[model samples]
Target: DAGVTQSPTHLIKTRGQQVTLRCSPKSGHDTVSWYQQALGQGPQFIFQYYEEEERQRGNFPDRFSGHQFPNYSSELNVNALLLGDSALYLCASSLFGTLAGGQETQYFGPGTRLLVL
Candidate 1:
C-alpha cells in the first residue's frame, strides 16, 4: 500500500527550459492530481487526471500540461518555464466518485522541488 511517489526530488533549470515531473499513485487509487506550492504558500491545484484523461484544471497557463497512464502513474510537464514557476510540485492520489457526504481524502507525495534561474 505504497502512497503516491514523485521523481527527481529536486531540480534546477533556467528560464525557457522544460521540465517533466513524474508520479506513481497509491494502490487502488484511480485519480491523480498535480499541485504547485511556493515556498510559503499552500498548494494550488494544477490539474487532475482520471481514466487517462484530464478531468479538471486550474488557472495555470498552457505551459503546464500533464498525462496519466493506465497504471495510474502520471507526469507533469512545464514548457518555457519561468522563474515564477519555481516551486514544489506535488502529486495526490484518491479514488474518484468516493467523496461521500463531501468527505474525500487525498494522499500526497513528498513532491519535486523545482528551481528556476
Candidate 2:
C-alpha cells in the first residue's frame, strides 16, 4: 500500500512567481491538509479539505489554496508568491470523519522545499 508522496523535492523561484506542489494521500484515507513549516518553527496549518470541501482553514492569506480530488490526491497552489513564502510545504493525510484523540495525528510526506529569491 502506498503511503503519501510529493513531487519536486526541491525548488527555487523568484518572488512573484507561482508554484504548485502535489500530494497523494495514504490508501484508505479520505482527508488532506496542507502546512507550511518555516526554518525554525513548527508546521503551521494552512487548510484542510474533507469530502472535497474545505473543512478548516488557518490564518494564511488567500495566496495559499488547495484542492482534493476523488482519489484522495491533493494539490497546493500559491499565487503571486512572496519571499516570505520560502519554506517547506508539507502535505499530510488523515481520516476526517473521526478525529484522533481530539487532535489529528497527520501522516506526512516528504515536503517540497521551496526557496524564493
Candidate 3:
C-alpha cells in the first residue's frame, strides 16, 4: 500500500506570506503527525491529529497550525511566514489499523520542502 503522501513536493514563499501544505496518510492508518526538520537537525514534531481532532501538539508557535479531515487527510498551515519557517515538513501515519489503540509505530512520508525568502 502507499505510505504517507504530501503535496507540493517543493515550495517557495516570501516572508509574511501564508502557505498550506497537505498530507494523506497511509491506507488503514487514522492518525497523522506533522514534523519540521531544519537543514541540519532532526525532525521536530509539530502536531498530531486523530479522528479529525487535534490530539497532541509540540512546542510550535501559533503560526503553525493544522487540521485533520474525516478521511484522515491533513493540512498544515503556516501564517505570516518567516525565513525561519523554511524546512522539510514531514507527515507520519500510525495506528487505527490492527489491534486496540495503545502503542503505535509511525511511518513518515518523503516530506515537502519549503523555503521562505
lDDT of 1 by residue, 1-117 (tens): 688899999999999999999999989988999999999999999999999998889999999999999898999999999999999999999888756512147889999999999
Candidate 2 error regions (>4 Å): 100-104
* Cα shift from native, residue 97, model 2 (Å): 3.4
- Best-matching candidate per TM-score: 1
Pick the winner on lDDT between candidates 1 and 3: 1
Order of candidates by lDDT, top first? 1, 3, 2
lDDT tens readout by residue for model 3, 1-117: 888899989999999999999999999998999999999999999988988988778999999999999999999999999999999999999984555533288989999999999
Which is the leading candidate under lDDT? 1
Candidate 2, 1-117: lDDT as tens digits: 988899879999999999999999988888899899999999999998888888889999998888999898999999898999999999999887555422356799999999999
Give me candidate 3's TM-score against the actual structure. 0.93
TM-score per prediction, in order, is 0.94, 0.93, 0.93
Off by over 4 Å in 3: 96-103
lDDT-superior candidate, 2 or 3: 3
RMSD, one per candidate, in order: 1.8, 1.6, 2.4
Off by over 4 Å in 1: 98-103
Q: Candidate 1, residue 57: CA error in Å?
A: 0.5
